[model samples]
Target: MPEVLVQYQAEIWQAIGETFIMVGVSILAAILIGLPAGTVLFLCRKGQAFENQVVFSVMNLFINVIRSFPFLLLVVFLIPFTRVLIGTAIGTAAATVPLSIIAIAHYSRLVEQALLDVPKGVMEAAISMGASLKELIFKFLYVEARSGLVLGLTTSIISFISYSTIMGVVGGGGIGDFAIRYGYQQFKTDLMVYMIVIMIILVQFIQFSGTTVSRWIDKR
Candidate 1:
């Protein structure tokens, strides 16, 4: 067993690296897009910042549609669109396209929920103080609710890690592909077990770090 591990150690590490790449890039993109999307969703809703019933309904429907699709079908469904954007539909890069979209849709709702947790009075106070819209959002909403936002982002990232595993079905190189090829197909239960252990540890670390940071930042 030790010898087998030693022999495939490089492959194992490479797969881990690939998994990190997929998760990291996807999460970053999700944050960039989802944050604004969620902010807009929040602001456009009834009785909110820029409340527009028509715009809110449209954005809400779009988000719901994207979030409703299962990840597997989402990957398959995006094959054509993915091909158009990246010129191929099977690889880490191609895989990232769908993963990012999934992350954005997933995280946007989380962000919206987090922002909603902010007190209505906070907005009232900020506006009364003559705060600009930018100041109200960035300084008041985001700053005051930062801990919740962090927790939301942390949850989304952990979910992204799990979702990335499914990318193996499309020839995306990650721990999932590694496990499917060398562990399941080759009947190497040991490798499979190792992968599971690694994933567990990764999840634990993410949870721990997120919680710790949230606690540290939280004044209330």
Candidate 2:
């Protein structure tokens, strides 16, 4: 056990860093793109602001198709684009392109759902006060839906963290890669257990923190 640790400690640390980087980049991208896309999605479906049936229909189909794809398959399927975009397909950075793309599509729906949870009455209240589209979206929609949106993001970030683990199969490097290579391939059961536990702890920490923050923000 000591020998294994000595041999692979560097690899484990490197993998942890890689995983954090991947998940962080993906989360940022998802928030940037998904929030706007989700708002558009919610407001354009059959009614609401800027409703264009054709645009909504087309975007709806596009989001659905992308979201329906399995994350692992999406990574593999986008190899060409990843390479073209990043000039490689086997590192943490390269893997992030596909991860972010999928994250955006997946979280966009979550964000839209969160926004939908806002009371129609709240929106109407803003409109009755002569709120412009900008005010409606930035203030009314977002303010009322802030709690749900935070939780949705909390859930998406955790999922993205899990997904980042699989990037190891393609040399993406992360704790998952460390587990697979040292734990599974080398039959180091203890190492695998440790890695799994670490992942769980990371997730639980995020969940607790997110919940606390959300409850604090959601003043009813």
Candidate 3:
């Protein structure tokens, strides 16, 4: 194993770098897009601050329809769009497009749910105190739901990592692609085991950091 690691150290590091690129870009994009989307969804829901039946229904339908598609199918389905946007649908950059789209929707729903968990009375009290919509959302809703939001982001990050692996199927470069080419295709069990171990360690670290951060912020 030590020999093998020494032999493939450069390739392994490169693959790891590619994985981080895909996951990092996807997660960052998701947070920027999803936070607003989820907040809008929450505010526009029936009986909520900005409730509008038509807008809520349309947005809800759109999100659910996209979410209902299998990730692999979504990847294939979005190929043309990805190609048009990124010039090709088969590299880390191309892969990032679909991953970010899916992550946005996924994280949006998560954010909406997290915000929903905030007590209704909290918002009402804020309103009674002459809080504007912006103030209410930023100060009360988001502050109260910060822990849940962090955990949701954590889960989304982990999920995107898994999805990045799947990107390997479509020629998207990452550790998964490397494993497929060297580990599975070449029947190198040791390589496969290495891939699994690396993924497990990465996931464990993410989970631990997320938990610690959530607990630290959770005043309640």
Candidate 4:
């Protein structure tokens, strides 16, 4: 091992664990809340099964507003709310508040787009077969859009990892935070490069896995 890695192996491992916690929570929020929210958005569109212009407009506007904020600013802006919810806006837990909010917004838009890509004929066919709303979605819509959904989730996870990097501003230490504090601040350029390389490898692995799984499951 390089001198830098040997010197900071423990810290590096701790940082990785912190990053996983933040990203894991964000992923959970994305799937549990964002997925349903996107489904609702799709259902409420102008001509969908549960079409309601008012609901669609309000939800669309809300998502747009959330996504419009620059991520750094969004983190600072949510400090008070984070404190209220997590009892402090200065740690990994507090950082998750903003990460999760952004994850939901980010993943939801992609999910909506993925669902939109499903052919209208699929819906019509499901309805013609007397499929209920739930059955139509499970048996037709989601099935057809599975690959896109997986791809969107993979994309969202990458973004979440990127977002987690900036959490160091709030003392939410992760690998990025470690690099900034120990490597950049200390002028250890090689260390910083190593951290960046790790991140690149992590992202590449995730993308490849997601793509492979998507292709394997995709029927059309």
Q: At residue 125, give the lDDT of candidate 2.
A: 91
**Superposed model 2: Cα runs more than 4 Å off:** 1-7
Error of 4 at 33 (Å): 0.6
Per-residue alpha-carbon lDDT of candidate 1 for residues 121-183, written as tens digits (9 for 90 to 100):
999999999999899989999988899889998998899889989998777888878888899
Ranking by lDDT: 4, 3, 1, 2
Clashes of each: 0, 0, 0, 0
lDDT of 4 by residue, 138-178 (tens): 88889999999999999999999999999999999898999
Q: Give the CA lDDT, 0 to 100, for residue 154 in model 3.
A: 94
What local distance difference test score does each model get? Answer: 0.89, 0.86, 0.90, 0.95
lDDT tens string, model 3, 11-53? 9998999999999998888889988889999999999978998
The segments of candidate 4 whose C-alpha lies over 4 angstroms from its true place after superposition are none
Residues 1-220 of candidate 2: C-alpha lDDT, one tens digit per residue: 4666667788878888999999999889888998888888888887675678887788788889888888889889999999899988889999798789878888889988898888889878998999998999998899988888889889989998888988975678888888988899988898898889889999999999888888988976
User: Best candidate per lDDT, number?
Assistant: 4
TM-score for every candidate vs. truth? 0.97, 0.95, 0.97, 0.98
Backbone clash total for model 3 is 0
